[model samples]
Target: MKKILLLSDTHSFIDEKILKFVKQADEVWHAGDIGNLEVTDTLKKLKPLRAVFGNIDGADARSEFPLDAKFEVEKVTVWMTHIGGYPNKYYKRIRDKIKLNPPKIFISGHSHILKVQYDKKLNLLHLNPGAAGNHGFHKVRTMLRFELDNSEIKNMEIIELDKRG
Candidate 1:
């Protein structure tokens, strides 16, 4: 079983509260809008990181991460991007590609909205951990934690931080 810490939209902010949780997770998956490479560098120092670059990210982040991250964890196929839409309202750029090849888990971030929905039509789990940083319109800073065991995803938990500062 692998403990996963999923977060996004850090916007160049990182605090002790976030690090406390990061230390517990076996791996960290960043969906995007990382804002700066320091956020990723910090996380990488603590645990394994899987990330994609976001609209707000600059050349440094783009050079370090991919526009789309596709890989598997514990036998589960996973695809991650920064601006991927959810379900029927998927972003146009990736809609056709998603339909053609679906993953067991699809993750994206940008709206700063926390979401965890199962796309029945495509048979995939969609996750958006909201804005973990204080730089967006989101009122609550949030992240997600879960366990991947074999091909099963279990013990999902939503981690909410203090109101955006």
Candidate 2:
């Protein structure tokens, strides 16, 4: 089984509670809003991290960091993005970006909402870990855990660190 820790919209800095979970995960994926390079550095100290650039990362159109990524883990194809190519928003450019490369598991952030979707059309798993850091968009603090084994998603966990108030 592949144990993975998924976090999103940190905005910079990370949750201390998240640190405990990171040690138990084989890999970590951050959806976006890293805020600064320091966040990445901190995450790396815990475990190998895979992440993407969020809208707040900066306005550099052609920055070295990619907005999308495809990775293979435990024989499962996972896709990573900040806002997600297939989002609720309406933007032709964004739509086009996602269409360029389809993946089995799609990860994204922006809304600060903890969500998980199963898309039959593309046979994909959409996961949003919500915001691990106190970015202040939502009233709750959330994060996710994914369990994959033999190319199948065995289970998932949505962890609430604090209630929104």
Give the alpha carbon lDDT tens digit for every residue of 1-165 in model 1: 999999999999999999999999999999999987889999999999999999999999999999999999999999999999999999999999999999999999999999999999999999999989999899999999999999999999999998999
Cα deviation in Å at residue 118, candidate 1?
0.6
Error of 1 at 52 (Å): 0.5
Task: After the best TM-score superposition of candidate 1, give how far the Cα of residue 65 lies from its true spot, in angstroms.
Answer: 0.3
Candidate 2, position 128, lDDT: 85
Candidate 2 lDDT over 81-161, as tens digits, reads: 787634444245556555666577888888798888876656677888888877666888788988888888876998888
Worst 10 residues of 1 by lDDT: 32-41
TM-score of 2: 0.86
Report clashes for each candidate as comma-separated counts.
0, 1
Off by over 4 Å in 2: 59-64, 85-91, 94-101
The per-model lDDT (C-alpha) reads 0.96, 0.77
